[model samples]
Target: MKKILLVGAVLAASFGPTSVLAEEDALLVEARKVATSLPPKLIAALQDEIQKSGAEAAIPVCKDMAPKMAGEISQQTGWKVKRVSLKARNDARAIPDAWEKAALEDFDKRAAAGEPPAKLEKGEKIGNEYRFVKALPVQPLCLGCHGPIDQLSPGIKAALSQNYPNDRATGYSEGQIRGVISVRKSL
Candidate 1:
């Protein structure tokens, strides 16, 4: 009877943590799905706009349409979604909160240590919320506006200046982390 009771206690203790881990894992998976749903659509829209007009014309897709799309995703998924960066282009929108800042810093360190920027992501439960952030690696398509400021086309520079006078989101190379798609849901 004593041995059976001890075994039962151990099993219960182990299953307690296992269940919590499983719950967190499920939250992470759902958060990942919500976070990932926006980028491809934004990229496609930007590509279409760039092709229809020019890189200069595509600026509105990122500056304006991306936020609207994120809003829609938030409504659909019950997760608040936004993009953030260490070097924010639009200070009003892209500034990272304390938690996001820590994750972004960690992502940059990991990327610098040779981890693939695209694969750098963080997800966990914080208080009453589950939060996730997926690194947004700079792509070739992002180069026209996000590359070296000196290399930006005159038209692109003018548009950026007019739209975001204090933009700091430049000087990024392909594969570098440009920002993150951050999502959080209240639990």
Candidate 2:
């Protein structure tokens, strides 16, 4: 009977809240590090300069590098990261993946209200399917690429039209949700 009780206690302890807390701490630490540091200041400064010079210069960089940046972050952290720009239109391909679409919307609302967004959990249907989501707020520097369309220069508009004919990521306000950082840790 004592042996049986000891085995039960061991099993319970192994699966206790303490283990879960440790996992959460580890994930949070990793997430914060990559989110805060991966996109260094120089990249942001360059984007700002491009925007100030004219939209044309900045849009190209945003269009070309957004996805690549996400990929790079994923490579650095071993966790998948995705950027989901908000869109006014609901076209098939623009928002093809339901999870990404939903996550973006949710993040937008929280960001607009000035509430800090939380990390998406497993089983949450955020951007692609069971995506774990964290919001990426538009920094002041990000205004160059993501700010209101009306403020964009003719050159920028032209560049945007040339690069992404179906681009729907414009007309954003400061502190808006520009994208998300997603991760799916292995079991």
> What TM-score does each of the candidates earn?
0.93, 0.66
The residue-by-residue lDDT of candidate 2 on 34-71, one tens digit each, is 55554464367466756587545555455456557767
Candidate 1 accuracy as TM-score: 0.93
Give me the overall lDDT of model 2.
0.59
lDDT of each: 0.95, 0.59
For model 1, state the Cα shift of residue 165 in Å.
1.1
Q: Across residues 54-83, which tens digit of lDDT does each residue of candidate 1 receive? A: 899899899899999999999988999999
Least well predicted 10-residue stretch by lDDT in candidate 1: 14-23
Name the best candidate (by TM-score).
Answer: 1
